[model samples]
Target: MEIKDKVIEIIAEQAVLEPSDVTMDSTLDELGIDSLGLVESIFAIEEAFDISVPFNANAPQESDFDISSVASIVAGIEKLVAEQKA
Candidate 1:
């Protein structure tokens, strides 16, 4: 699957929703995901892409990774995948 689609699927699974329900503009908070769910989602993404996310759940604001929105998360993953392939 494509990166966007796969990411959406992962996020949706964490939110207990379907892929169709997840939008690029959707935020984790908007999806009703708590801190635990956000951490789970991050782990799922890392496993899915075989890339470590630079996220600090304890201090999210200080993290290099941007989890502000689904689109941003996808962009971060895409960048990480590209860098890994390099």
Candidate 2:
């Protein structure tokens, strides 16, 4: 599956929703994902892609990775994945 697809799937799982319910423009808050869910989602993404995310779970606002939207999260993960292969 594509990175975006996989990301949406993972996020959907955390939100207890279907992948189709997730949109690139949707923020985690809109999907009812709280701080704990966000942390879990980040961990799941890191594991799924085998990449270390430079995210500060306790301080998301200070993190390098962007979690503003599903699209942004996917983009950040894609960049990390590419860096790992380089």
Candidate 3:
């Protein structure tokens, strides 16, 4: 499966929604994803991509972050993958 599809699958599974309900522009908050769900989704993404997302204590909260959108999540994963390859 493509990275985008994998991301959608992970988000769908984590958010307890159908893949069809998730669009690249869909926001996680709109999907009813709470704090814990965000963490789980992050972990799932890490495992799925085999890349560790660096955690920053001063980083914005998931609520404050804009990773709710599928496009944003894909960009984040792509960034991580690029960093790993560097």
- Model 1: lDDT of residue 61: 86
Model 1 lDDT per residue over 1-56, tens place: 99999999999998899999999999999999999999998899889989988888
Cα-based lDDT for every prediction: 0.92, 0.94, 0.79
Point out where model 3 deviates above 4 Å: 56-58, 61-68
Error of 2 at 43 (Å): 0.9
Query: What shift in Å separates residue 15 of candidate 2 from its native position after superposition?
Result: 0.2
- What TM-score would each prediction reach against the true structure? 0.95, 0.96, 0.82
How many clashes (backbone atoms < 3 Å, residues ≥3 apart in a chain or on different chains) does model 3 have?
0
Which residue window of length 10 is worst by lDDT in model 3? 56-65
Alpha carbon lDDT at 26, candidate 3: 87
Across 1-86, the per-residue lDDT of candidate 2 in tens digits comes to 99999999999999999999999999999999999999999899989999999888778889989999999999999999999968
Can you tell me which runs of candidate 1 are displaced by over 4 Å?
Answer: none
Candidate No. with top TM-score = 2
Roughly what TM-score does model 3 have, to 2 decimal places? Answer: 0.82
What CA root-mean-square deviation does each model show from the true structure? 0.8, 0.7, 2.9
Show the colliding residue pairs in model 3.
none
